[model samples]
Target: MQDIRCGSCSRKLGEGEFISLTIKCPRCKTMNTLRVTRSEPVCPSASPIGVSIEQTHHPVDRRQTSYG
Candidate 1:
């Protein structure tokens, strides 16, 4: 679990596991944006002794296309 704080006032906003988030600060009214990629360990009991679990992350593209 991760804690999200206000950028201006350092107030505790919320907590959770998020890939991308946009939130407003209640105290300072500042806009906050966060992007994260987390890799957690897989439970050993769930998988076989020789098997392994893998996680992959990809980047997001935020581009605008114009048509003439």
Candidate 2:
């Protein structure tokens, strides 16, 4: 609920900027690769990165195949 601002420029980030960035803290002005909390997905928004989806299916394919 807080506006994450750019410390060096003192620019209060707008909503579009906030969603694009990953880090939010005072020292971010000078620091690089700060560990930021994973952001929760907004309604009707894209999912997080590095997520793998696994799909499981029954033995239907094996049963349908005939001997060759």
Candidate 3:
């Protein structure tokens, strides 16, 4: 991966949470993770792959709730 300057701030997004991110210019720090569209030369005829996952884990309060 190449070091890219933030399009908005022109600062190097070289710190935490910035490395190897695919969406949202790493420095400007936006919330949205955008979908990467296909362009010629880089990615030809992009085939998309997506997955839906549901995870269940015990909450911090492991005590039984009335609802449960």
lDDT tens digits by residue: candidate 1, 7-60: 667789898877677787767667777775434447744633342222232233
My TM-score estimates for the predictions, one after another, are 0.52, 0.23, 0.24
Q: In model 1, which range of ten residues has the least summed lDDT?
A: 51-60
lDDT score, candidate 3: 0.38
- C-alpha RMSD in Å of predicted model 3 compared with the true structure: 12.7
**Candidate 2, clashing residue pairs?**
none
For residues 1-68, what per-residue lDDT tens digits would candidate 2 score against the true structure? 54555544444543332223433334333221212345456655767544332222122122455688
> Which ten residues in a row are the worst by lDDT in model 2?
53-62
> What TM-score would candidate 2 get against the native?
0.23
lDDT of 3 by residue, 1-68 (tens): 34434545555544342312433444445422212232345355555354322212221333566873
After superposing candidate 1 on the true structure, give the runs of residues whose Cα lies further than 4 Å from its correct spot.
Answer: 37-68
Clashes by residue pair, model 1: none
- Regions of model 3 farther than 4 Å from truth: 15-35, 39-68
**Model 2 spans with C-alpha error above 4 angstroms:** 15-68
Ranking by TM-score: 1, 3, 2
Q: State the C-alpha lDDT per candidate.
A: 0.63, 0.37, 0.38
> By the lDDT metric, which is better: model 1 or model 3?
1
Q: Candidate 3: minimum summed lDDT over ten consecutive residues — where?
A: 51-60
